[model samples]
Target chain A: MPNKNLVGIFDSDEKMLHAAQKAKDLGLSASDAYTPFPIHGIDEILELKPSILPKVCFFGGATGLLTAFTLQYWVHAVYWPMNIGGKSFTAYPAMVPICFELTVLFAGVSTFFAFLFLRGMHPFKTSPFWGLQTENNKFALVFDLESESKAEKVSSLLNQEGALEIREIIE
Target chain B: MTTATASSEILRPPLVEGGKTYGQITDDICAPMEKRPPLGWFVAFTVAGLALLWGVIMVTDLIWTGVGTWGLNKTVSWGFAITDFVFWVGIGHAGTLISAILLLFRQKWRTAINRSAEAMTIFAVMCAGLNPLLHMGRIWRGLYWLFPYYPNTMGPLFVNFRSPLLWDVFAVSTYLTISLLFWYMGLLPDLATAAAHAKGAIRRFIFRTLSLGWSGSARTWRNHEKASLLLAGLATPLVLSVHTVVSMDFACAIVPGWHSTIFPPFFVAGAIFSGFAMVLTLLTLSREFLGFKDYITLKHIDAMAKVTLLTSMIVSMAYLTETLIGWYSANTFERFYFINAATGPYRYCYWTQMLCNVVAPQFFWFKKFRRSPVVAFIISIFINIGMWLERFNIIVIGLHRDFLTSSWTMYHPTYVDWGLLIGLFGLFFTCFLLFSRSLPMIAMSEIKHVLSSEKHGEKQHA
Candidate 1:
C-alpha cells in the first residue's frame, strides 16, 4: 500500500471531462477515471481503444454452432441411429432450433468471461477506493504518481480545474 | 431548431422527472430495502407466501401420488400443466422486449422498468420450469434423460432428435442461462455502488463480492457497454427463437387445432402481449408502492399501454385467422374443433378470453385509459386473465375433442390442478418481492446516462 496515486473528485461528469481534457492538454498524463456511470467522452478523453468484446462474441457464436451441430449429429446419426416417426436420424430441421439457441448461449457466456478477464476484475477483490462512492453521485480521476515533481503539478492542476476534493491514495 | 421539434418538446416532458441526481436516484430506489415493509406489502407478501405454500403442498401431492392427482386422461394427456407452462413462458416475453429489444432501439425510458421486468421474466420462467418438471412423473429419471452428459455413453434410443419437446429443452435452458447472465451483468455496477454506500460490513462485503470489484473505470465501462450491446444483439434473436420453439411443440403435432403453420408468429405475438400485460400489472403496483413516479413517469406507462394495444390487436388477428382458416379449409375435424371451442364445454373460457384479451385492451387505444395507472392496472389484470384463458382454450379445448366422436370426452381440472395453477402467482410475486428489496429496482446506470445530457446542459448555462 506504499505506492501513492493522486486522485481528484468532481460532482458532475462534465467537470471530470473538463479536468481530464485540461490535464491532457497541459501534457500531464492522467489515464484513469471513475464515474457513477459512463461519461460518453471519457474513454476517448483517456485515449483508450475500442473494446475487442464484439469480435470475441462472434468467435464464441461460431464455436457454439460447430459444437451444437456436431453433438446433435454425432448422437443421433453416427452413434446409435433410431427410426422414430419414420424420419431420418439426423433430423436436421428439428436440430436447427437447438443449434440457434446454443449459438447465442455460447456467445453470451464467452463475452461475459472476456469482459471480466480483460478488465482484470474478479469478485474476490475490490477497488482501492471502494469506500469513496465513485460509482454513486461523484466522479474521480486516478492519476499515476510517477514522481513527487510530476504528482504535485497534477495535484495543483486538478485544484485549478476546480476539483471538489483531492486525496493521495496508497496502492 | 424546427417548429415541429419545439412543439413535440412542449408536448412531452423530459424522460425522468424532478431532475434527480445520481445520489437522489439511488436514495429513491434503495431506501425501501432498508426500511420495514408497508402494511400493504406485509399483507401482499403474506398472501403470496401462503399461495406459494399451498402450491408447494399440491406439487408435493402431485409428486407422491403421481401425475394422476390432477386430471390428465387418455386423450388429453397435456392439460393445465402445459397450458400454465406456456402462459408463464409468455408472461416472461415483455422483460426481454423491454431490456434487449428496447436497448437496441435506444429507448431510454426502458431504464426505469427493465430491471423489474427482466427479474419477472426469470421468475416466470422458473414457474414455467416447474410444470414440465412435474409433468414428468419420474422427474428423477426424466430430467436425467432430458439433459446430455457423456452422450456417446447414452444410446440414440434414449432421446429423439426430431422431437420438438427435445428442442424445447435446449431452447428454454439456453434462454434461462443467457437471461441470468444478462441480468447479472447489468447488476454488477449498481451492486458496487450499493456496497460503497452500505452501512454494515457483512452487507457491504456481500454486495462487493456480487459486484465483482466494479470500480466503474472508464476502460471497464467501455468494455461493459460493448459486452452489453453484444449480449442484447444475441438475446434479441434468442427471445424470439425460444417462443417460436415453444410454439413448434404444438404446431409440429398432428392434432387438428395444434397443427397450424400460423402458430409460430401467433404464439410470439401472444407471448409478447401477455408479457407486457404482466409487466404493466407489476409495475403499476410497484411504482406506486415504491414511490418511483418521478423515475417511471406517465410517459412510460402510456408507451407500455400502446405496446399492449398493438400486441393485443396482433393476437386478435391471429385468433381470427385461426378460426377463419379452420372453417375455410373444409377440414371437418378442424372446423368442429374450432367451433366446439366456442360452443362446446369450454365456450365460457373462449368467450372470456375474447372479452379480456381482445376487447379489454381496446380501451388502451383511448388516451385516458392509457394515462390512468388504475384503469391500466385493472385492464392489465383482465388481459392477464384473458391470456390464461386463451392458452387454456387453445390447449384444453383442442385436446377435449379429438377426431373420433366416440373417443371424444370433456377434460375438467381437479382441485389439485386449480391449486398448482393459482399458486404459481405466489412464487412469481414472492421472488419479485425479494428482488425489490435486495437490488436496485431500476437500471441506475442507464438512467444516469439519460440524466447526463440535462446535467451537461445546465452546467454550460451556469
Candidate 2:
C-alpha cells in the first residue's frame, strides 16, 4: 500500500521541478501545486492531465445556441404567432441575426457565471486565501504533510535548494 | 561572436535603456506644456468650464420649466437635440474603436492616442446621453426608458420591440456599459503601474483599490489579456449594433429622405469617418502638447490619415449612392429632398460638407500631407465641422421642406441652439484637458510591444 500523505517542497522552480521529476522517477505520489504565477511545466510535474475547461466551454456554447434557437422559435413560431406583411409567422431567416447574438450572449454569460461559481466568488467578500505577499512578491507551494520525520526531510531539501523563507502552514 | 553578421542581425539593435534618456523623452513630449503659460492655460480652461456650467444651468432650468424653451416646433421636433445626439454619439465611436478594435487587430500605432480617444468616448457618450433626457420634457420619466416602462404602467412598460428608438435605448446603454468596462479594464494594469509609484497613503489606497490588487504577474497578465480580448470582441459587435440601431431610427421612418436602405452603412461609415477625424484632431494637439512624439509617431499619424481617407471615401460613396438611388426611386418627394440638399437654402452646409468630407480627405494621398500633423489637424477639424453639418442637413433640411409647400418655411437655428452647440465644445475640451493632465496619454504596454516587435523585424532585416 502507498502512503498519499507525503509531500515535498523546493526553493526555486528548477529545483522543485527537478525533485518532482526525480520523485516520479522513483515512483512517489505527487498531488498538486500552488504558485503565484502558473509555472509552465508544473502540471507535468504533478502528473495532472490538461484541464476540461475547453470541453466545458464547447458544451456551454452549444447549449446556449440551442436555447437561443428554441426560445426564439417558441415565441415567434409556435405560440400566438401573428401574420404581419404576408410573411411567415415563424420568420426563421430573420431570426438568424438575433439568434446568433443571443447565442453568443448566453455562452459568454454562462461561462463567466460558471467560472465565478467554480472559483467560489461572491459579492461583498474577501478571497479565501489572504496572503499579503500573494498581492505582490512571493510565490507559495503547498504540499500535504505526512509523518513528522518526512516533514523534516522535506524542510531540509527545500532549504538545500536556496529557499529564502519557509514555514509550516497547518490548516 | 563572429565579426561578419547577417544584414538582419546587424540592423537589429539591442534594447539598451540608455539609448534615449528620460530627460530627452520628457523634453520632447512635454514641450507643449512648457511653452505655454500656465496662467493662460488655467484661465482658458476656467472659461470653458464656466461655459459648460452655463449649459448645465440651462439644462436644469429646462428640467424645471419644460422642453418648450427650445424652438422645437411639432414638425421640427428633433432639430438641434437629435442632431447633437447623433453628433455626440458619432464622436463616441473613435475612442473605443481605436482602443479596443485596434488593440484586437494588434495595431501598434494606437498606443499614443488610445488613452485620449477612450476618454473622448466616455465624455462624448456622457454628452450624448444628456440630450435625449433633455429632449424628453419630463426628465423624471427618464428611468422609464431603462425599464421599458411606458405612459400607463406603474412598473416598467413592455419595451416596443419594433421601434428603432426603443432599440436605440437598449443598444446605446449596452454600448456605454461595455465601453466603460472595456476602458476601465485596460486602465487597471496602468493604474497599478501608476499606483506603484505613489508615495502617499491616500493615493496608494485609492490606486490599489482601483487596480484590484494587480501586480503585473504573468498569471494576471494572461487573465487580463484574455478579459481584454473578450471585451474587445464583445464591444466590436456592440459598437456596430449601436450605430446600426441609430441609423434604424431613420431607416425605420416613413419619410422619403429618412426611409432608405443605405442609411445604416452610410451612418456607420460617417460615424467612423467623423470619429476618426475628431480623434486625429485631438491626438495631434495632444502629442504636440504632451511631447509624446516617440509614442505617437509619424507612423500613427499616417495610419490615421489613411483611415480618415478610407472612411471619407466610404461616406462620399454613400452620399453618391443615396443621390443616385433617390433619382432612380423616381419618387418625386425623394428627388425634391436630394435636390434641396444640393441647391436648397442650406446649400452652403451641403457644399461645405462635400468639400470637407469628400475633397479634403484627398490630400491624405500625399504622404507629406498625411505625415504633417498640422495638415491632419486642419483636415480633422474640417471633418468634425462637416459631420455636424451633415447631421444638420439630414435633420433640419430634410424635414423643413415638408410636402405641403404652404408649410415649407426656412428653418434656422435659434440662439439657444447656438449656445448649446458652443457649450458642447466646452464640455468636450474640459474633460479632454483633464485627461491629458492626469493619465498617461499613451498605452505603455502596447508601445512596448510595438518596440519589441519592430526590434524583431529589425533583427531579421539587418
Candidate 3:
C-alpha cells in the first residue's frame, strides 16, 4: 500500500510517550508503538480501544462450571450409575472439587488462547520489526510511508519530536 | 553515604537495587542465557541430566517389570509412590502463591522470584504427575483408567465419580493447566524481549512464536495485565483448592491418622512451606551462580524467609493440633495413631519431622540468619527433608499400622523407590537448568514496570 514503512525509535520512555502524542497531533497515520515495558496511559495516547479479554474469561468460567456439572451428572446419574459405600447415587458434595477445578481450567486456558488469537500469535511467525534493541531497551513507533514527499515529512517530524532514529522499514 | 542517609531517607532495604534502568535490568536478567553459560551451569546441568536419566530408566523398568519393583504391599498399599505424589504436589504450591496470591496482594518483591518459582511449580507438578502413574500396577494402562472419559471397554459401569482419587485427577490436571497458563501468560512480553535479543534466526523464530508477536504495545499491556490479573484471581482459589483435594484423598478415608477436619489447612500450609523451601533452594543456587544478587536481592531472600517462618509455625501448630485433637477426642485408635507416630517404629521420622519442620525454621526469627542466603538455603534444604518425612509419616506410618494388629507391617522403600525419589530431583534440576539457560528466567518487563516505584523506595532508603 505504501513505498516503505517509516519507523521512529526512541531511547527513553518519556520521549517516546511525548513523541507518540506529537505524531498523533501531526496526523502521521501511526499504527504501532513498541516498547520494552508497558508505559502507563500510553494506550489512551495511542488511541486504541480497551481489550475484551475479561468477557472471554467470564464466559469461559461459566462454561467450565456447566461442563463439570454435566460430566458428573452424565457419569453418576444417567449413564451406568451404581451405588458405592452406601452413599447416594448422585454425588453433589464430591463434585465440588472437580467443579472448581474445571472452572479454573476452562477460564484460564480459554482466556489465554483467546488472547493469543486476538494478538496474532501462531506457529512459524516472526514479529514485524523485531530488532535487538526494540523489545529490550528501545521503543519504536511505525507509520506507513505514503510517498517520497510524505516520507520526508514523517522523517522531519520524527526528528523534531526527538526520536533517536528514523529508519525505512522495508518489510 | 551517611550524609545522604541523614536527610530523611530512612535506611529501609529496597527489594530491587534502585540504580537499575530498563536496559540494564533486561541485559542483567537475560545475561545468563545470552552470554555463554558459566561453568556452574554446565556442572549443574550435567549432574541433573545424569540424575534425570537414572530416574527415567527407573520409571521405565518400573513400568516394564510392573509396580512390584516398589516396596508396596496390601498392608501399606500406597507407600512411597503415593507419598512421593503428595510430596511433589505439595512442593508445587508455593509458585502459584507467589505469582498469583502475592501479586493480588500487591507484593512487588514477587517480581524477582516469581518466574523461577512458577517454573518450579510446573516441573514439580510434572514429577508429581508421574508418581501416581508409576504407582498404578497395570503397565499398559498406568492410570489410564483413572481418566473419566478413557472409554471403559468391558464395563457397563463408569469410573468412580465419587472417589477422592478421581477428584485428584481433575484437581491436579487443572492445577497444572492453570499454572502453565499463568506462567506462559506472564512470559509473553519477556519472550518477545528474548526473541529480539536472540542471535540466530531459529532462536528468534521460536521465541517469537512463543511470544505471540508481542510488541509491548500499551493496548497489549492493558490486555495482558487484565488477563494476568483475572488468571491470578482464578489461580488464587486453585492454589488453595488443589491441595485441599489432595488432603481429602487422605482425610476421606477412615484411617485414624488420615481422617481429620484439620487436614485441609494443615496440608495447605505444609505445601506452601515445602514449595517455598524448594523455591528458596533453587533461587539461592541460581542467584549465586547466575550473578543475579542485585536483582534477587537480600530483601527477596529475607521476605521468603519470613514466609518460610510463618508457614513453618502454622505447620508446627498443625502437628500439635492433630495430636491435641486426637487426645481431646478420647478416641483410642486416633490417640494410638498419634502415639505410634511419635513413639513407635518410626519415631525417627517423627522426631526429625519435629526438628526440621518445627524447630529448624525458628532460626528465621533472627534477622541475621534470615538475611544470609547461604543460611536460608541450608534451612530450606532442611525444610525439604523434613517435609518429605512429614509425608512419609502421614502416608506410610499410618497405613503400616492401620486398625488390625494382624495386618501391621513396616514398609521399607526398595532401591527403585529411593532411586526414583533421587532421580526426580535430577529431573527437576535438569528442567530448571535448561530453563535458566533457554528463557528469560526473570520477568524483565514486570520488573521494569515497577522501576519507578522501586526508585521511590530507594529514595526513602537512601
Candidate 4:
C-alpha cells in the first residue's frame, strides 16, 4: 500500500467511475474511489474480484436442507416411530416444507454475516475514511500515489482535470 | 424572494415534461384526488368501515358461538371463509410478485403498480389472515398453531410440520413479513422526499419518525439499494413458496379430484393470473379517479395486461392438465369428480370460470384492447369472478361428493356467507381508499429512477 495521503475530487460520479476504471485497466495497485452515492460498477472498476457471499449462501442453504432432513428423520423415523394412520416413517414428501423454510432462513442469515465480513463492518469501529460529506453532496476519488511528490502531482492533476475541490485526508 | 433565492441553486430540478420525481409527482398525482369533495370520501369510508366492523362482529359471534352459527358443515367445511382466504391471498401475490419479480427482470413499467400492489398485498394478507382464525372452532387456540403451547392439549401440541396447514402458516407469515419489509424499504426514499417538501409540525414529526433521520446520503442510498435487492431476492422465493404451500393443501390430500402433482405450479400460475387482473382493476380506477394518466400511462396497462394474458394461458393449461391427469390416472372416482365439476349442479360456476379466466383474457392478445382501460377493467372484474368460481369449484365439488354414495350431498353458501363475502369487498376497498389518501400510491422514487429524461445525454444502457 502507498503510504502517502492522497485524495482527488471529481465533478461527478461518472468521472470518478471512469478514473477508477482507468486505474484498473493500467494494472495499478493501491487505489480507492469515493462518491456521493454508489456508482454501480465501482468494485469491478477497482478489479476487486467476486465476493465469497454466493459460496457462503450456497453452503448455508445446503446446511439448512441437511439439518431439516436429519431432524425430521430423527423425530419421525427413529425417536418415537409411531405407526400413526399407517403413514410411512421415512416420509420424504412431508419434509419438503420445513426443508424449504430452513433453507431460506439459513441462506438469509448467513448472507447477512458474510456481507458484514466482506465489508469489514464492525459495530464499534468508526470508518477509517471520513468523507461523510460524500454521503450527501460530493463525489470523491482517493488515490494512493507512492511518494509525497507523486501525491502532490495527483492532487494537482485532479484540480486541472476539473475537480471542484481536493483535500488530503490523514488518519 | 430571498427565501426563493436561498433555495434557487438547490436546482429546481427541471421538470421532465411527462415525468416527475418522487416529491414532485405526489402533488401532481394526489392533488387531483384530494381536491375531489371530502364528503364522498367520508361517505365511502363510513359505509365501508361499518361493513368491515359488522363482518368482524359476525366473525366474533361465530367464534363465540362455534362454527355451528355459520352454515359450514362436514359437506363443505371449507366454505366462503376459505374462498375468501384464497382470494385475498391470491390478490396479495400480485403486489409482491409485481414489485420483486419485475424489479429482478428489470421491467420499468412496474413503477406505476408496485406501490399500490404492495399496499394491496399487505391489506389482502390482513384479510386472508382472518380466515384461519375463524376456521378454527375455537379461535382462542390460534396460538397452538404458531407455538407448542396449548393448555390441556396433550403430548406437546405443536404445528404439524407434515401438514399442509403448517406449510401455509410458515409460508404466509414469511411472505407477509418479506412483503412488509420490501414495501417499507421502497417507501423510505419517497418518504424522505416527502419530508423535504413538507412544512408543518405534524409533517416534520411524522416524517422524522418514519424516515429515521434519512438524508438521501450516498452511503444510505448504497445500503438502501443493496437491502432492497436482497429483499427482492428473498421475496421472489417467498412468493412462490406461499402459493405452492397453498396448493399443497389440496395436492397432499388423497381426495379424488384434489390429489395431483401439477397443483402447485397450477395454483401459483392462477394466483399470478388473478393477482394481475385485480391489479389492473385497481390501477385503472385509481388512475382515472386520481388523474394520474401520465404517471400510470396506457403503456403500463398494456404491460400488465400482457402479464395477465400470459398467466391466463398458464392457468388455462393447468385446467387442461387436471382434466388430462384425471383421465390418465384412470381412477373412476377422480374422473367422476372432474366430470361432476364440469357438468354437475356447479356447472355454471365451472363454465363461468373457464370463460372468464381462460377466454376473457384472450382479448388482450389484441394490442388495441390491451391498452384500453375500459376493456382491461371489465376483463379484470371477470377474472375476479372466475377466480372465486374456481375456488368454489375446487373446494365444493371435490369434497361434496365422497367415495361413499350415501355421503354425497349438495353444498351451498348461506346468506351470511355471501354477505361476509360482499362485506369483505367493503373491507378491501376501505383499506385501499385509505392508502390512496394517506400515502404515495405510486412509487415516486422508483418512477424518478426510470424517468427517461434522466437518461438524456448519458444513456448508460443497463
Number of the top TM-score candidate: 1
In terms of lDDT, which candidate is stronger, 3 or 4?
3
**Global lDDT for candidate 2?**
0.66
**Count of backbone clashes, every candidate in sequence:** 0, 7, 0, 0
- The sequence of per-residue lDDT tens digits that candidate 1 reaches over residues B1-462 is 356546545664687899788898877777777677788888889999999999999988998999998888988888889999999999988999999999898777788899999999999999998889889987877755687666435453446656788888888888888889899899988888788777789998998899988989889888998898898898899989888989999998878899999999999999999999999999999889988899888789999999999999999999889999999999999999888988898889999999998899999989998999999999999999999988888888888798878878878799899889978989999999989888888888778877885544322210
**DockQ scores for all predicted structures:** 0.71, 0.10, 0.57, 0.14
Local error of candidate 3 at B364, Å?
0.6
For candidate 3, lDDT tens digit of each residue in A35-153? 78777656776778878899999999999999989988888888867777687768698888888889989999889998878877665556457773767888888777766887887
lDDT of 4 by residue, B187-291 (tens): 765554454455566764575457444444334445556656666787788788888899888888888778888988988898888999889999898878776
**lDDT of model 4 at residue A87?**
91
lDDT of 2 by residue, B172-197 (tens): 76567667766776676555444444
lDDT of 3 by residue, B347-399 (tens): 99999989999999999999999999999999999999999999999998889
Model 1 CA deviation exceeding 4 Å by range = A1-3, B1-11, B151-156, B457-462
Worst 10 residues of 1 chain A by lDDT: A125-134
Error of 4 at B326 (Å): 2.9
Query: What local lDDT score does residue B83 receive in model 4, on the 0 to 100 scale?
Result: 83
lDDT of 1 by residue, A1-171 (tens): 477889999988888899999888888868789888877777777889989999999999999999989988987888777777698877787688878988999999999999999988887975677666787888999898878898888989999888999998887
Docking class of 2: incorrect
Error of 2 at A23 (Å): 16
- Compute the interface RMSD for candidate 1: 2.4
Candidate 3, residue B105: lDDT:
88
